[model samples]
Target: MRLIKRLLPAFSMAVASAAYPVEWSGNLAVEVRTFPSTAQWPEQKDNGLSLSFQPELRHRWNDGDQAFTFIPFVRVDSMDEERTHADIRELKYLHVADGWEVRAGIDKVFWGVTESQHLVDIVNQTDLIENIDGEDKLGQPMVRVTRVLEDGAIDLFLLPWFRERTFPGAEGRLRTPLVVDTDQARYESDAEQKHLDYALRWNQTIGAVDAALSWFDGTARDPELLPGTKGSESILIPYYPQLRQAGLEFQYTGEAWLWKLEAVHRDTEQEDYRAAVGGFEYTFVGIHDTPLDLGVLSEYHYDSRRLAANSPLQDDLFIGTRLTFNDTQSSEVLAGGIFDLDHAGKSFRVEASRRIGQSYKLSLEGQLFSDIASHDPLAAFAADDFIRIELTRYF
Candidate 1:
């Protein structure tokens, strides 16, 4: 409530600006999931059901130099209380003038281009309860400035408040043995949640490569899990620490082929390490005289610290394929898996999606975790394999 109250002034300023006319659009979706395997824990049930609503509003005026946008999202779940939540995905004011752009309010920023995982993308917190994959992110409160030049672009970010990552509740599947108590989490900095973080990125395209060099000095997004007790029940206490990170991202483009590299080095009081994910993809266009295209992808991920590892892909290899069917519905199917070379752990995913009729869409996804080593944290949820389906109707 305090945070909402503090940020209301920004919202009011955007609303009071008469420089623009408003345009709005929204969508309502119903999604369901089934757990093919038995219950991973006693607190969770067998299946999950949910409904979501998302609406987007935009206003642009002042000769298109100023703009405002609001995207609000909510999901109601029958199986998990924690998953049934709402978010102000994007509510910001943007202005552009003289090769300069500024954005203020809650927004999402993506920095990396790899398919397997994001290494240098740390602006927004992960919405882990939304999906097993770490793709979904929580909007962050920030004020950003970008300078556009002929050679390249430089972006500066001022993060006022930090948003913690979300986790599943007790009655949710795909959770760890030691449940996480987000409310009891601790921060290493004296300023706590109000710590202001800063980041800078200079991006440019040279020849066939689009590359960026970034540096971040602030609180680390990845929290260190610590052991605790919740009224005799063991739990994990997430601890957020302060750190500095430098990242390099590059993508080389060619005819029907792409090479991507995302690498980062970080320094903290406790540890200093470097990690990288490098991969390439080659596509077969118009396969067999058909309109469909098949893309083959392979990536290798390496981390410096590997003992008692929490990351499933600490020292792993990933291989995947994407099949795109050139049709009116815009359908696509993807199959991917990651292999942990050192720990003999592996995880596979199969996903497909297609549009239905004119205003509806359907999606199916399945995940399997296999041969998880005891030293790895993923061994706890190895038995939790399930297939999920979702249908969305756009307005």
Candidate 2:
């Protein structure tokens, strides 16, 4: 079984490349991050650099009824060894029929409706070393079947393997006071990483509203950080508990206005809680007769656990603005702030990007933390404000 599992990926790639003409795309990026504040930990650095590459290859046959896709990613970081890693972002085979489709292999899936937080996206484990917003995810090994309906779709997934979430090492910034010992992870399930997880989702569109209901039975992607000792040094041990979650997503699109909501109820052996994020975005197009659009967004996040919640978003509010320049270069910018209602902690962020030329792009991002409560999760980052720049070349 182990031998076959090891060779399956290679064998699938060989077959795909031989049977069809491969289509190639993706990008290579160089990133630099700068911190203005002094390092809180002696092992941390004030500046960092990294290079990342992701190439996508696809093969399709039978007039698009059958296909194969492969996406491999690698990153080399100068500051943190844990951040320097490689992953298969996607490697999947897909087949489509009259009313249904089937896919198998490693893939990434997203399910959420709110902009501030995604409470319902649970299929893929988070790649925290790549980013803090949970926008990046590791590919998951799954076999999924989807039934297409006239106005809706139903998807069923069987996940055979589990991917642990990545955490920053001792040298990485925005880390906990104690470094996470990823090597000593503990799981509630006796089967551990081999535990079989499954999920089901149904989505439908009615008028201007789109809705989805989903349920997942599996190991929780967000592990509990427990304090432990590692050879006379303090460390945080990751503990994965079994979880059953029910999720709800809703979005209503109107003329220049979008309303979104995402909610989840999660049950575990130690704790059970309900969490939700709801928000709206209103856009003003052609403010002064130019091809510019401005969108105002506001969202509220709530967790039943409140102060006891493991998440930092409990009882918080997010307000942001998105500006899009409808030009050839596709310039865009987003600025936002999340305010903790209970603790008086706030974090502000700004992100902007534009195409430099036909094959290159430039992006800038910044974050600021202020007035963080001592008990707030973000207190550790109070002195870790930084700016990031990225240049990418697309091939």
The best candidate by TM-score is 2
Best by lDDT: 2
Give a tens-digit lDDT track for model 2, residues 312-376: 99999999999999889999999999999989999999999999889999999999999998899
Each model's backbone clash number = 0, 0
Q: Any residue pairs clashing in model 1, and if so which?
A: none
**lDDT of all predictions, in order shown?**
0.90, 0.95
- TM-score for predicted model 1 compared with the true structure: 0.93
What value of lDDT does candidate 1 attain over all alpha carbons?
A: 0.90
RMSD in angstroms, candidate 1? Answer: 5.4
TM-score of 2: 0.95
lDDT of 1 by residue, 141-190 (tens): 99999999787899999999999888888888888877899988899998
Worst 10 residues of 1 by lDDT: 15-24
Q: What is the TM-score of each candidate against the true structure?
A: 0.93, 0.95
